[model samples]
Target: MARVLIVDDDKNIREFIRLVLEEEGYATVESTDGRDALRKIKEHPCDIAVVDVMMPYMDGISLTKEIRDIYNIPIIILTARGQIEDKELAYTAGTDDYLVKPFEAKELIFRIKALLRRYGTGEEEAPVRLGNVLLYQQNYSIKIGSKTVKLPLKEFELLYLLGKNPERVFTREQLIEDIWGLDFEGDNRTVDVHIKRLRERFRQLSVPARIHTVRGVGYSLEVDE
Candidate 1:
């Protein structure tokens, strides 16, 4: 499930949003104001933040700018005003989307899902970038600088899965189900062999990206640089 942070000073509004979001199977963290939201975001690292304007401290636009400076998570600015000026300010502050007050539950859920897909958060597939490595599905290849290599079918799919959700561990069983068919019989060794091949390929590309093993758990992709 995707995680969301809801920031609002009104207890009723916060609870309402939390209920709606939880009903849709989303994990939510609630905050009373911008400062609290910032703390929650830093500690918990949510996938998206739904912020209310005109709060006690920092305000929504300011909080958006601050979050943009640090984390790359998507932000949705919520406000009571319908003024274009407020929308422009929110967008200028780096909010990915904007929603007015009294929004319908379905609209809010739709916007959240759209933003998640656009940002490649959770399990959604999209083109991913880490340092100089670019994985694009349009061309079905990995592009490093001017050289683009179309990997073999399995290799490409495996690399794409790892790249799609960077820093998120996927156990061997999860990887097998995601990349290969669930009916395909495979052991942990299969994932190991594919990971080995990906490592060698990236080593040849000379990029900052690397796949890390989580001992007895699984594997995650990390970029150092």
Candidate 2:
């Protein structure tokens, strides 16, 4: 499991982010401020760091610069500031990504996965096998028995994420961020539409894996036994 360092002065926010990351299988370390966060990172390096802006001892932008100067770890700034100038400052400070306050839990997870993949640090996701069907990550193609079929980009990535985790359930909100992105203005029904199309395509190809909906919750990929 990847380790994530969470830096925030607000205990509730820290805990909330921690819960979200922990639920997604990431180990978390928490700090109350940027000064403390720096010390923690030096003592226990993490794969990624989620820093909050407007903290006491040291602000997130300053911390981001310090971290960049010494470590190659990816950084994501979580703040209530949505101003363009604030975002520009974060990018200038070497932040890999930024998330505004009141963000979706799924969006956070999606960004972390994206950053890991972008930096080539999270390559542990394996190809999915379901009876006669195979979901290839590298080529972004699906194989059904002897035939190889290429799916649309979003569909392929969505299917791969679900298939890679097998029985793990993913909420519609999670799907939206993982596929449409956090900036997407669409509703959750968009996920349903994609899943419907994915199912239809799988049916046409006679693929054995099916996406199962968890009522009022999310969806999961189920492989036939």
Regions more than 4 Å wrong, model 1: 125-225
Find the 10 residues in a row with the least total lDDT in model 1.
177-186
Supply every candidate's count of residue pairs whose N, Cα or C atoms clash at under 3 angstroms: 0, 0
Decoy 1 TM-score against native? 0.56
Runs of candidate 2 exceeding 4 Å displacement: 136-155, 161-178, 186-225
Best-fitting candidate, scored by lDDT: 2
Best by TM-score: 2
lDDT of 2 by residue, 1-225 (tens): 789999999999999999998888898999999899989988888999999989997999999999999989899999898999999999999999999999989888988987877676765556688787888765678887678988887888898888888899999988887788879898999889889999998788877889999999999998878
lDDT of model 2 at position 126: 64
Question: What C-alpha lDDT values do all the predictions have?
Answer: 0.85, 0.88
**RMSD of candidates 1 onward, in order:** 13.9, 4.6
Estimate the TM-score for candidate 2: 0.71
